[model samples]
Target: MRPKITLALNSLLVLAFFLLLWQVLTVLLHVPAYILPGPIAVAAVVGSRFSSLAASFWITTQAAAIGLAASILVGIAISLIFAQWRWLRRLLYPYTILLQTVPIVAIAPLILMWMGSGIGSVAFIAFIVCLAPIIANTTQGLISVEENLVHLFHMHNATPAQVLFKLRLPHAMPSLFVGIRISSGIAVIGAIVGELFAGSSRVGQGGLGYSITYANAQLETNYLFALVLAATVLGFLFFFLGIFLEWYFLHQWHESRRAESGN
Candidate 1:
């Protein structure tokens, strides 16, 4: 069997073993469904509440996707500016770091206040949470180009724009992708956090965070577990999307792709 297939099989086996153990322990110990719903119970909730869950999933996905896309575009632009100006980078980069250090929960309300309670606010929160990594990694990549190659470009009378576009950007692709992968997971968290405060009030109109809050309030442990699973799946989707993009862009010449293939 191929390595990818084998790895997937291993993962499924582990998941099966875990679920089996969970079911057995719950049954043997007489654990109440409220305290810990077994995987079977969670699956039942998933089946019964499929439409509701799917609607919420789509809401969260929209927020996360918009935020991630904004972060990529704006972050890359900021990184390019930083790459061109050392003094400006010194002045502004610390503030970006400070932005990252501040808790998103603390600022989420302010975001809702400024942007209003909607998908836009949620996406902004996601953008705020995930923007720093893109700026950091992409800035490093843009600046870390080989000095020899830079000199070669200069010798050919390459303009600053030419050097930036032709040499620096290409060299930065791997690092940019790394930032994107890291930020993808964070974007989901931000969107969910945003939804907690800014989600719609109407039934079945909110995102996973709203569903989670509703479940907790109702003390519906089984439904809550299912919602949690849905959130996890959403995060995984973003992460795998990042991985696919990295492979698609870098597979041609990057050493990482070669290493993965060999392994």
Candidate 2:
């Protein structure tokens, strides 16, 4: 209870301080509203257009969800492949690095060309962006299963699938959850990036990305800020969801989170 209260208070204080600074900057610089609208102005724009913004948010969320699911499937499959075949891990490890280093900005255009416009392209981009972390972490977990445990299972005549399901998957839970937490935010970013490259299918209905682009074109600084705020909120929600899941999973019997929970 005390920690939760402290966290809530800290969050409020930070938000208040930032809002104050923004308001002050707007006045001191005599900043044109087109360049940097004050927080109040941005709030007003968000309040007025919230309904339309919500619709775009729904589209963005759908893309993020689909992408995240795909990432999990691909990640687990790749992890299993690498775990079973040491030779393949050695061969494809470099390629994994290549994928990570290629830069999402450069790849988005190619994805757009291949998948065309609409949710498919966006989801594909998000999946690609989030795939590496899951693969790497889950592979580490799957491979990190205790040798003694494996020997014990083998002595019992346990099959590979049985050992994996009973022992390896349990051992992998911590690392896999870490990957999940990291991938959630990445998925959101990929979705937004995909939207930027592909643009919105319909007018008056794009994700936050479209709103930002539209705001820039019309020199509507407040609207731009509002759109950015929406995106930030979206990312925060994803991160928080990951945190909640981790708590739900790890708090039960895990030492680290159990200690944190004072259980």
Candidate 3:
């Protein structure tokens, strides 16, 4: 059997077991739907409200995608700059790390104040949360070039740009992809946080965060569970998107993928 196929089947079996447990627990405990809906009930709600839920989910996903894309561009650019000069990295990297210490919720309101209440502000919030990992990972990747390689480049009288594009960038891609994966996952969390602070929808237009909030306010546990599941699926899609990218970029030559592929 193909490894990917085997892995998928195993994942499904585990998911089925947990879902069975969830159903049994709810029935055994006689939990009220409003308080603790079973997976079955959540599935039913998902089926019944598929349209509205899907619409809201798309909104949140768009914000996450936007933020993650921005983080990738800015992260790579800044990482290159850091690699080019040690002084800049020393002066600016601390502030970059500072972003991780503060909670997204704490700064979300300030973003709302600056960017206003809209998708742009929400994307900015996600951008902030997703920025640190990429910068940190990519910077290390660039700086960790082999000493012999640096000498080789210098001996060839290569320009800094030539060295970076030809040697450093290629070397750093694995780490860059790792950062991409991490940023992709956290981007969703950032979007959810942004929506928690500033999410509002007019009629049919809403995001998952807004739906979750509305469900809780109205004591709709099944509906909340359904939206949460949709958000989970959305995040999973983004994560696997990163995985596919990693595989595409690195599978050609990276030893890890080569070994995995048994090539």
Candidate 4:
């Protein structure tokens, strides 16, 4: 069998084994459903509340997607500026590190106050959470060009803009993708965290974070499990999307792609 197919089958087998063990442990220990619902119970809740779960899923996805997109555009621009100016990078890069060091939960209230408790606040929080990685990775890639290549461009008398666009950006693609992959999962977590504080106040309208809070309050463990599963799936969706983009763009020329293909 092909490697991809075999890997997928192995993953399914592991999942099956885990589910079987969980079910057996719950049944043998006579565990209460409220404390630890088995996969079967969670599945039932998922089936019964599919619509609500999907709605919440969509809300979180929108927040994460918006935040991630903004981070990519803004982060790349910042990285380019940093690459062009060493003194500015020295002045500003430490602040980016400081921002990353601060916990999102600590800053989220300020975001809510500024942005007024909506998707905007949530997306901003996500953007803050994911921005540092993109800047760090892309800046490193942009500055790490080969000395020989720099000399070649210098000998050609290439303009700064030409060198930046034609050389730095191309060389930075792999690193930017790495940052993207890291940020994709982080954006989901940030969105969910943002939703906990700033999600819609309207009845029956909110994201998975709201659903999770409600489930915990109501002691609906099975429903909570279902919501958690939905969030996990959402994170996986973003991560796989990043993976696909990386493969599509880099497969032809990148060393990583060659290694993956055993070339």
Task: State the displacement of the C-alpha of residue 48, model 4, in Å, after optimal TM-score superposition.
Answer: 0.7
- For candidate 4, give the lDDT of residue 58: 98
Candidate 3: minimum summed lDDT over ten consecutive residues — where? 197-206
- Once fitted onto the true fold, the runs of candidate 4 whose alpha carbons sit more than 4 angstroms away are 2-7, 261-263
Candidate number with greatest lDDT: 1
Ranking by TM-score: 1, 4, 2, 3
Candidate 2, residue 46: Cα displacement in angstroms equals 0.7
TM match of model 3 to true structure: 0.93
Clashes of 2: 0
Q: Per-residue lDDT of 176-236 in model 2, one digit per residue for the tens?
A: 8788889999888989998887757677677777667777888988888888888888888
Cα lDDT tens digits, model 3, 1-263, are: 59879999999999999999999999999989998999989989989998999888889999999999999999999999999999999999999998788878888988888877778888888899889999999999999999999999999999999989898988999899999999999999899888877665364366787778888889999999998888899889999999999999898789986786664
- In order of lDDT, best first, we have 1, 4, 3, 2
TM-score of each: 0.95, 0.93, 0.93, 0.95
Superposed Cα deviation of residue 149, candidate 2 (Å)? 1.1
lDDT of 1 by residue, 174-253 (tens): 99999999999999999999998867647657999888988888989999999899999999999999999999999999
lDDT of 3 at 112: 82
On residues 1-263, what C-alpha lDDT tens digit does candidate 4 reach at each position?
Answer: 59889999999999999999999999999999999999999999999999999999999999999999999999999999999999999999999997689989988988898888878889899999999999999999999999999889989999999889899999999999999999999999999999888687686688988778888889999999999999999999999998899999999889986796673
